[model samples]
Target: MGGYDGLVVLVGVALLLTTGRCDTSCGGTDGSPGVAGTPGRDGRAGMKGEKGEPAVKAEGPVDEVVLLTLKGEMGNRGLQGVMGPKGYRGDLGATGRPGQPGRPGPDGKNIGHGQQSAQQGHSAFSAIRTDNSLPRYEQRVTYQTIVVNKPGDFDKNTGYFTCRVPGVYYFSFHSMSKVSMCLRIASDALNEKLGFCDYNRNNDQVLSGGVVLQLTARQKVWLESFRDQQPSTDQRDTRDKYIIFNGFLLFSNDPELHFSLCGTGRGGFYFPVCSVRLPIMLHHFVLVIGALLSFAVPVKVAMESCPAAAMPGIPGMPGLPGRDGRDGEKGQKGDPGAAWAGGLGPQKGEKGEPGLMGFPGKRGQSGEPGRSGEPGLSGPPGEAGEPGTVGTQDRAAFSVARGTNEYPEKASVIRFTKVITNINNDYNTETGRFRCRVPGTYYFVFHASLEDRLCVVLKLDQTLLTSFCDHRRGRRQVTSGGLAVHLSQDQEVWLETKDYIGMRGKPTGFSIFSGFLLHPH
Candidate 1:
């Protein structure tokens, strides 16, 4: 093994020594370097060579120059090494530009609400009478100035509202007259009158009345005067200032029921037959389709082979038997019945003897009870009764308004001077307190208008019952508070500012303090 190792080392040195022969030998410059050849295929690994003996140590000194010269140009890079470990994930990529917007979708269909709105069933009418002519007895008051009459149900010429839809309606009227006036709201559907309004004051008088009625289609309603002196209208005052009639449908009972008066104004009564209305859109669509069909098929042939009218519906069930009819008039006598069957052809039979009278016959079970008797006449007035005991007159009530704005000291009672009402003089304006006259529960309320902050407390004899506060920046504010408290006789209650005093008063009574006795214990 030592000899073989030495032989291999000497052979490698000889190759190295011959590699510089071009530099040492006298040879012309070398030709251009040859092109790189394609790499050779790797040979299969051979069996493991036997381990050489331990390297022998050389005895002479090793030259560093020889070692340096033995090194050759780096061999071609070894076959690509196995793939390295996966690197750390790279930073997130930049955001991409937005794409062009997609085309708009087709137009959407109109969707109707499943539930109908409350405003859809609107039916209202308003009118004013400006004519000075007085209507005759039992005549309708004509309102020529028609303010609003939706659906054209009101007849200004006849002064009657003929119903077009069945629903509950509210009717109201206001009349101003100096002379006596009496009006009646009448409906043809009902036997009794709806409402009445009477004003008999010699001075200017106003009267108003309202009524709610359930009306059916084709029913006529109007305001009429049955008395001799009807409500006089003013020709000067128009513009709905007086003698105005208004009516509106509150809610509908049936939305689809419609009627058409047939054979009206005949010798007999008029009958209104019900009808159903189809959608206008549906009718238009059906007409279009029919026109197209008529064009597609020759009109001459279509008309020649026209279909027969639809067969009538099956007859309804038979009704119940009618009531018995009245008797017919008697016929004329028939020649005296042929002289009583040959007159006296046969002789009269012998007269029979009279039978004996029977007893009373036990009263015949008293027959059926007689009907109730008519009401008796009212009796004369009775004598006057004795005088009764007097009621407790212990009452307390007051309503006062402030006349000016006040910014009182802290914890001061608010003085209300302008007294609107003071029952039994229980509220003292000087002290700004209501001294209870009767021991009972009393309710007190106060309203204050302010431009700044305000905190008020309702005090019952120095004990606060409740507090109210209103704070706003720019606009005026109003605050109201109420409380019911039980008070003994002479106990006082009043309104006062708690910490901040802010209040404004007006002649219109914007600030008010009122208290009333609910009951006396």
Candidate 2:
């Protein structure tokens, strides 16, 4: 058949097959439908056609069949069309609000209170009692009674107060005696008397002494009658004050509160803020505030506002003049002047007769020795002298020999008591050790004579430098070992036996440990 007739026949057969399979009327229930396929991607847009030639003016109406026939099959996909013009940039996104602030962290630990309580219990105490009891001179005066003991720092039995803290402390002592007496305040910590009070009258009198000092922990202070003072026999009521000794801590040496509250030039007191009691600080603070307020107001205005000042009063008689002060000490005598020479204007008279010799004046005491003067500047070094005959170099050298030929115990260090030659005294005969005075290379030798097995070791400081062992038993066995070692200054070396070694009863000086410095580094 012709090509066109064959195609037409196939088309007719396909139509008939499709028509026969289609069922218009409903019959049995339909089977479940298969899942729909995914939609296909849309085809890319076609390239724009050239501007149409001026629209043709057509008198007849356009025909749809002609337009449909004009459409052509799609050509091979053209190169990807140019990307569409970029779209207008969108408005910038609104900035996000700042995140909320994080919650505050927990508070730090409290340090002020802990520092303030470090020296909370520091205090001083003292008292005096009178009941016909007298203490011997040069002895500690016990009050036998206490009036105030804030911290119990003083011991009534010992009549002494041991400082409990390292800080400044104030001590005071008072005594009442019927007869003339002297009292002394002494401190073992200072190894001397701090102060003394003396009453020179036979009638009853009071003597007191006080001292402020920086004391260290465990330091002791006390009051005692002066040596050789007469004992008092006067009887007095118990209520009468006689003797007392007391001291108290001013402040501690806590570093946390170290600061000067006032200037030392004005006799100011200084204390650690942490060591001061709260009550004392508050009291001081109140005083400071009151002082500031008082200074801020006008004194004259306040005085005028007072009722007493507003009412005038009659003037009183003047007070008598004060007595004149005692005379000052006499001045020292001046040395005699040399005789003047006669002037040329007039001739001098004959010299007077020699005056009678006055009794020899008492020999004046020798003057105290003068203090040593500072050292003078060093003189320039002298020129080198001519060279002399060359001699052996004086290298540090030492040799030791056994004093007694006796067997050494097992595991004991062998001591060389007899030093044959110690040029530099580097070897200690008592310790049997050689200490290196100069850093250098050294040669050490150990010679041992034994009849039985023995092991010897040479140790430098704590390390073994060399060792020797001999197991043979001979009538006269000799074992020798040596080592060349580098030693640092102050390093020590010695020889020790690992096992028992036999020795001749006679002093042969065969066994020896010796070392010599080869060259200083």
Candidate 3:
């Protein structure tokens, strides 16, 4: 290899003449041109000790010096290098998410529509035009225009006709307004309103139109006088022209019609400007079929009409709408979804849902206590039942018990005296109650006691069975059919009670004998 490249160029010029390091690159010289490198550190450390020294090959020139470099400047922008290592971690950033909500749009066609406008009746018929704002006048012209809103300007100049015959109608309009004989209208036909005016002023201002009443079976509509004609800078009478109409008449109001007006004046002119033809009032068509309500849909008459070019209200509210800004931080709770254990891999979202008992679960053990009751028998002696009423007020005025009763009626009246009377004497009373009506066996006798010691037997239901009768062989007259006693279909065994102290000298028989019986003993 040519002596191993001339002994590696004289051992790199003897190690650059012994390390005087001439700006390194000690290889391709010839002044300056790039791409030719590698030869320093003393030409590779003295070519490892001159391998064979008999090689020279590197003529003159050993010192080097040229250091003012200038190569396209774009460097030192570093420090930006560390970011490169982060590349492999990219996939995890895709969570900038939430873009998946855009697919729900086609359900909009509710497309509902309906519109009708012919405001009120008559709408138009003509004499020269006059609109009497109401009574029964309703000028609905979806075929032209006249509704000036209120009687303020009176039907604006109502006039139209093109219906064969249905019946009932009267309408008008005799507008004068600084006149140009105006009346522009069009909802679809009679295309007229080109313009004009001149209604000579002097306050005679005679222009009237209105009658509307009864119009059935309608017939489209058509007519025009758009009245116009004074277009020469009209100020009314700017060279007055004559009359061209007077045979027109239409009205509806008739609030008991009594209306009438008259006019006359021709100083240099033509005549015949009074006209009429209008109707829609049998009560304004019954107030338009009583305002057809069922949530109203009459829409005046529905459109295929009102379109003179319909344009009145919606084009973005005209003004005011813009204030909102200052709300930014409540967004942190979202990251727990991707199975959150460091990211993207779904598998742990299931523990939460147990709350809905505002109140209902404590009545399950009260249905099992129904089984302990069966031991009872032994009863057969009961009869004495009835008596119950006669209650007009004798609880003790006289006495009565056994199922309760003792009605010596006359309610609060017991003023019957006889025996020196006066014991609780609200007055004295003694119709002597010994009432014992039939159930046999009774002798509660009161023989006006005071007799030489008598028999005493009082009973108000102890059945005085004085140990089953015989009340102990009293002074005599003590009776009790005893044991044959059966009483219960309203049963009562009675006699006087209380003040009944008949033991010693037994003279206590208070007497009322007629009310007692029972000697069949």
Clash count, candidate 2: 0
Q: Which candidate do you rate higher for lDDT, 1 or 2?
A: 1
Between candidates 1 and 3, the one scoring higher on TM-score is: 1
Could you tell me the lDDT of residue 328 within candidate 1?
A: 48
- Write candidate 3's Cα lDDT for 103-185 as tens digits: 44443221111211121222322232233221111233222233332212122234334332232222222344333333221
* Model 1 lDDT, full chain set: 0.61
TM-score of 1: 0.28
The numbered model that scores best in lDDT is 1
True-vs-predicted CA distance for residue 249, candidate 2, Å: 0.6
Per-model CA lDDT versus the true structure:
0.61, 0.57, 0.28
Q: Give the distance in Å from residue 171's predicted Cα in candidate 1 to where it truly belongs.
A: 1.7
Model 1, span 308-419: residue lDDT tens: 3333444455455444444444444333111223222223334445444433333223334445445445544444432221133544566676767566557888888877
Relative to the true structure, candidate 3 reaches a TM of 0.13
lDDT of 2 by residue, 1-521 (tens): 69999999999999888666543321333344444445545545445544332212233333335444544444444445445444454454455445445455444322232322324446678767554555666787776788777667788888888876565565656666655445666785453453343323344555554544556667888887664333344222223337767676544444243336643222222443444445534333333333434346545633222221223334444445445444444444444322223322212334445444445444444445545445444544444432221112324556565667577667777787766446457888888888888788887765554556778788988798777887756434345677888988899988887755654322221455657655678
lDDT of 3 at 416: 19
Error of 3 at 306 (Å): 99
Instruction: Choose the strongest candidate by TM-score.
Output: 1
